[model samples]
Target: MEQLNLLFEGFQHALTPMNLLWVLLGAILGTAVGVLPGLGSSMAVALLLPITFSLDPTAAFIMFAGVYYGGLFGDSTSGILLNTPGNSSAIASTFEGHRMARNGLAAKALATAAMGAFIGGLLATTVVVFFAPTLVKLATAFGPAEYFALAVFAFLAISSVVSESIVKGLMSLGVGLALAMVGVDGPSGTVRYTLDIPQLFDGMSIVVITVGLLALGEVLHIASRIHRDPAAERVKPNGRPRLRKHDIKKAWPAWLRGTAFGLPFGIIPAGGSEVPTFLAYGTEKRLAKRRGDIEFGQIGSIRGVAAPEAAANATAGTAMGALLALGLPTSATAAIMLAAFQQYGMQPGPLLFERSGDMVWALLASLFIGLVILLILNMQFAVLWAKLLMVPRHYLYAGITVFSVLGVYAISSSTLDLWVLLGIALIGFVMRRYDLPLAPVLIAVILGPLAETELRRALTVSEGDVTTLVSSPTTIILYGILLAALLFSGAKHLHRRARQRTGDSEGDKELIDA
Candidate 1:
C-alpha cells in the first residue's frame, strides 16, 4: 500500500512537461539506434553519459530508462524487415519476424513486435515496482564474501556460459580485469601501471572505456567491414501496423507467457535477454507444434514474433530493478547504468532506496510512460523508422565515428583521453573481429575492482583464512549456483561437439534460433 502511494507520487514527477519531453526524445533516439545495425542500448547510453554530467541525475536516469525500453522494441524492426537484428536479444524475433515480412506480413510483424514489447515491459516493470524493495532487505545481509561470490557468479555466468567460445569469453574477461587494475593501489598506496603519467593516477575513467569500446569501437569496426559486407535488403512495409481481432487473439497469450519466462532472469546475471528470449521462442514453437499448427519455417507465426519480443523487453525492465536494488548488472546496458550511478556519486544497493527513493520511484514511473511513447512511435510508424536504412551504411558509421570522438573529448577536454580512446577502440575492433564477447569485458571491468576489494576485506577479517570466503550460507548458495551453471554449460558444450562429429546438421537451426 505504501508502495502504491510512492508510485502515485512518482507519476506526478513523470508527468511533468520537461520529463515527458525527455521521455519522448529518448524513445525516438533509442529506436533509431536500435534500427541501425552494430548499435545497441549500451552504446547509446555510453555516448550520452557525458550529457548526464550536466543534467539532474533523476532526469538523466529517467531518459536512460526510456532509451533502454525503447531499444527493445526498435531492434525488432530491423529483424522483421531487413533480417538483420541490431542485438542478439532480437535474434529469436528474426526467425519468424523476417519470414513474416517476406510473406507479405511486414506491417503485421512490426505490430506484433511492438505489442509484445509493451505487454512484457508493462508486467515486468510492475513486478519490479513491488518486488525490488524486498531485494533491498536481502542485500543488507551481504558481507564482502557474499558480494565477492556474487561477482564471481556473474563473471562465470557471462563469460563462460553465455558466450559462444569459453576461451574467447574468458580471455575478454581477463583483459578487463587487467584494465581494472591499472592504477595506484588504494589501501597500499602503491602506484602501479601508471608509467609515470600523472593522468593515470586516478585510473581509467569508466566513461572513456564505455564510449570507446561501445561507440567508437563499433564505428571503427563498421568502417573496416563496410566494403566487404553485403547490403541489407528489407521488405517494404505497405500497410499501417494495425492488428486484426484474430491476430490479437493469437498473440495476447504469447505476450503473457513470454513475460513469465523473462521476469526471473532480470536478476540472474546470465548475460542479457538472449536466454529468456530463446526460451520463450522455443516454448511457443513447441506448443504450436503440439497443436499441429506450427507456423515457423513457413509463413511465420505471429506467436513467434510476439513471445521473443516480449521476453526481451521484460528482461530489460527487470534488469533495471536488479541494477537499482543490488548494483547488479545483468546486461551490458545495465552495466553502463551502474557506471552512470557512480558518475552521479551514487552507489546502488540497499542504501540506494534510503538515499534516492524519490528518483528511483520516478524512474520506474517513467518506464510506463516510455512504453506508451514507444508503442505509438513503433507500431504506427515502424515503416518510417525503417527508412533509416535508406541512409548509406558507410555514411551512418562515419557520422558515428565523428560523434564519438567529440563526445569523448568533451568529457575532460584532455588529449590523453583521446589517445586512450583510440587505443581502446583498436582493442574493441580486435575483440569484435575475433568474435569475442564484449559483455564479459564490461562486466569484469565494472566488478573486478569490487571483487578484489571484497576479497582483501574478507581476508583481513578472517586473518588470511582462505576458507572464510565460503563460510557463510549465502556464499555457499551462490557458489553452488555457479557450479551448477558451469556443469550445465560444459555438458551442453560436449553434447554439441559430439553431435557435430556425427554430422548432425539437424541441430544447426536451433543454434541459430538463439
Candidate 2:
C-alpha cells in the first residue's frame, strides 16, 4: 500500500512536460539506434553519457530508461524487415519475423512484435514497482562471501554456459579480468600496471571502455565489411500495423508465456535477453509442433515472433529492477547503467531505495510512460523507422565512428584515454572477429573488482581461513548452482559436437555414394 502511494507520486514527477519530452526524444533516438544494425542500447547509452553530464541525474536516467525499452521495440523492426537484428537479443525474432516479412505479413509481424513488447514490458515494470523493496531486503542480507560466490556464479554462467564455445567465452573473460587487474590495487593502495603513467592511476574509465568496445569497435568492424556486404533494402509494411483476428489468437498466449520465461532471467546474472528469448522461442516452437502445426519451418509462425520479442523486452524491464535492487548488473546494458550510477557517486542496492527512492519510483513510472509512447510510435510509424536502412552504409558507420570518438573525448580531457580507447577497440574487433561473446568480457571488467574486494574482506574476517569462503549457506548454494551449470554446459557441448560429427560422417557417405 505504501509502495502504491510512492508510485503515484512517481507518476506525478514523470508526467511533467520536460520529463515527457525527454522520454519521447529518447524513445525516438533509441528506435533509430535499434533499427540500425550493430548499434545497441549499451552503445547508445555510452555515447549519450557525456551529454548527460550537465543534466539532472533523475531526468537523465529517465531518458535512459526510455531508450533501453525503446531499443527492444526497434530491434525487432529491423529483424522482421531486413533479417538484420540490431543485437543478439533480437536474433530469435529474426527467424520467424523475417519469414513473416517474406510472406508479405510484414505489417502483421511489426504489430505483433510491438504489442508483445508492450505487454511484457508493462507487466515486468509492474513487478519491479511492487517487488523491488522485497528484493532490496534480500540484497541487504548478502555478506562478502555471498557476494563473491554470486560473482563467481555470474562468471561461470556467462563465460562457460552462455557462449557457443566455453573456451572462447573464458578467453574473453580472461581479457576482461586482465584489464581489471590494471592500475591501483583496491585493498593495498599499491599501483600494479600503471606503466608509470599519471592517467593510469585512476584506472581506465568505464565510459571509454564501453564506447570503444560497443560503439567504436562496431563502427570499425562495419566499415571493414561495408564494401563486401551489400546495403539492406528497405521493406515497406504490407498493410496497417494491426494484428489480424488469427494473429491475435496466437500472439496473446505466446506473449504471456514469453513474459513468464523472461521475468526470472532478469534477476539472474546470465548476461542478457538472448538466453531467455531463445528459450521462449524454443518453447513456442515446441508447443506449436505438439499441436501438429509446422508453421515454424513452413510459412513462419506469429507465435515465434511474439514470444521472443516479449521475452526480450520483459527481460529488459526486470533487468533494471535487478540492477537497482541488488547492485548487480545482469546484462551489458545494465553494466553500463551501473557505471552511470557510480559516475554520479550513487551505488544501487538496498541503499538506493533509502537514498534515492524518489528517483527509483519515478524511473519506474517513466517506464510505463515510455512503453505507451513506444507502442504508439512503433505501430504508427514502423515504415518510417524501417526507412533508416535506406541510409548508405559508409555514411551511417562514419557518423557512428565520429560520435564514438567525440563522446569519449568529451567526457575526459586526456589523450591517454584516446589511446586506451583505440587499444580496446582493436581488442573488441579481435573478439568480434573470432566470434567471442562480448558480454562476459564486460561482466568480468565490471564485477572483477567487487569480487576481489569481497573475497579479500571475507578472508580477513575469517583470519585468512580459506574454508570460510563456503561457510555460509548462501555461498554454499551459489557454488552448488555454479557446479550444476558447468556440468550441464559440458553435457550440452558434447552433444552438439556429437551431432556435428554425425552430420559430417553422413555427408561423407553421401558423397561416396554420389
| lDDT score at residue 297, model 1, on the 0-100 scale | 55
Error of 1 at 356 (Å): 12
Ten consecutive residues with minimal summed lDDT in candidate 1? 229-238
Note the residue pairs that clash in candidate 2: none
Q: Who wins the TM-score comparison?
A: 2
The sequence of per-residue lDDT tens digits that candidate 1 reaches over residues 269-386 is 6447776776677667657755877476578999999998999988888888888888898888899889989989999876898899999889999999999998988877966654
**Per-residue alpha-carbon lDDT of candidate 2 for residues 97-216, written as tens digits (9 for 90 to 100):** 867775657777888899999999998888888886664455456778887887787676767743668899899889888887888888999997889997888777665665567656
Question: What TM-score, computed on C-alpha atoms, does each candidate reach?
Answer: 0.62, 0.65
Model 1 clash count equals: 0
